[model samples]
Target: MADKNTQVQLARQPDGEPKVSDFQVAETDIPAAGPGKFLARNIYLSLDPYMRGAISGRHMGHSRLNQGDLIGGRCVAQVIESKHAEYAEGDYIVIESGWQSYCVSDGAAKDGVRKIDPNAGPLSAALGVLGMPGLTAWAGVEKLADPGLGDTFVVTAAAGPVGGTAGQLAKAKGCRAVGIAGSDEKCRIVVEEYGFDACVNYKNDDWEEALKEACPDGIDVYFDNVGGPILDTITQQLNLYGKIILCGLVSQYNRNDDNDFAGHNMGPFVGKRAQLLGLVVYDYYDQMDEFLRAAVPLVKAGRLNFHEDRADRIEDAPAHFAKLMSGQNVGKAMVTIGPESL
Candidate 1:
């Protein structure tokens, strides 16, 4: 075992879009597992748009990564040394190992530690479709939105893990699933690969018209990720009693303005009597087993398709995260610390 461990730290809070210089890598002595704790060698790191908020210092209270703090994120790790009764050496577990090569943990806190059966699915899936993003999608679509037959459901950032999974779940529940994505390629994958009924390329000038045409009956449920012009367009087309799931506002994550509209229009709230519910996945973490029970079969049967844009090294995390914020990635953005393990 190496004596030193590498970790990515936030050099400073970002002003707008994050740059590589905003982060700095450091090498420190590998931490030893304390009594009732375990030391884990991280294998994969999950990079998400929410992390942008941390770097921007806008949502610092909601994130573990703060100025000069080691960049925090979830990871798939192999236990190298164990002092916990349940976790053993050689066990692969899902943990909040942050943006580092290793982490020390105790199986005491919520989301702090959980053993994963490597044989259940692709280990990486535990970070994407089968992990937090997946649970967020399932909670919003199944538990919150509750789409039904004849309902028209639309999701922004449709090519992303949460949107993609939400659209698939809507389809399975007999609703008309529509997607709004940044590029034609993303739209194609959402429709052709993920079985979405229609996907609108929001990059086009006529995207508003296209989205309107796709859902002739009006949108019954809107799962929003990017809340800018896309949201402005959707708000105008919501049906009576339409439900809006506010999962994210990636379009405004890095914005400096506190009063910026970011495509927000409240006219529909009263006129359509719409229910705009903000989703914080942590609120539903206790339902992990419920989500897994529903998602596992669909994944095994090939009914649900998850797209992953992976970087081979942890050093590439900053670049990949920039791509994600720019809507350049096709699916879940992840960094692989050890590709050989996969």
Candidate 2:
């Protein structure tokens, strides 16, 4: 029988790189499932760059975690016990269960919890391609940038979950997709697995030249994931009426609060009448059902492909998260909890 009680707690605030000292594995009495609630065993935990923002209290909107409270994010879990009418024992669901091994959920009444179709593909995919990252790519492409057929699209962090999905989505729409990744392997993956038209290695000696050569017609849509020198370079290559979807700034996540970029080259925007727009994935939550309706079929038919770098233990979450921030993860960095068979 499941003990039904126990969890890991945050021990301290991290400075720069997080150490094991920042976390504490603890045991607590599992609270009972209340009216319209269910008990769940966490099977997978999502480790995203946005979690880093939440940890530092830099995220906008309602804070998901307190200083010493359980760190909250998306997780895939199995229902162990239930008082909720919509759920049954052994049902697989996605919820905001934090880093703990178990949780009590009130069905889909809460934000981020949903009954996922386990047969859609791998259950872990509920936290990756077929989940938030996939929706992010769909909304960014369909709503924000709106790349037309044969349009030249450029995306940074091309090997990561959102970027990889975005690149493939662009290709599916008959657009010329160019990806920018940190290493040669990731660049190759973007071209081969994601079907990107071209890939540029940001770490290469002539990255700017390579980008220019690949995008001869200039960039029609720029999906900005890693900002810094790449943003500056992409800004200079915008075609007339080009659009840039600002997804994230992983490149600046570790910067000191004092430092700021100034005097960015805006000449391309002015000359080409291009627009750079910021996009927070949650803003498009209203269209999530629409996105899932479209994307899930592709996933089910094996048309869409995705990758995950799984860390076997929940205790390894912080390290995996650090790797994600450092561009060390090739795809979605997720931590697997409990048994693997689930």
TM-score of each: 0.94, 0.93
lDDT of 2 by residue, 125-237 (tens): 88888888888998899988888899999999898889999988888888999999999989988888877889999898999999999999988999999877778778888
Worst 10 residues of 1 by lDDT: 56-65
Candidate 2 wrongly placed segments (more than 4 Å): 1-6, 62-67, 108-111, 256-263, 340-342
Candidate 1 deviates by what RMSD?
Answer: 1.9
Task: Kindly report which residue pairs in candidate 2 clash with one another.
Answer: none
Residue-level lDDT tens digits of model 1 in 130-202: 9999999999998889988989999999999999999999999999999999899999999999999999988
- List per-prediction Cα lDDT, in the order shown: 0.86, 0.82
Best by lDDT: 1
Q: Model 1, 145: alpha-carbon shift in Å?
A: 0.8
How far does residue 340 in candidate 2 sit from its true spot (Å)?
Answer: 5.9
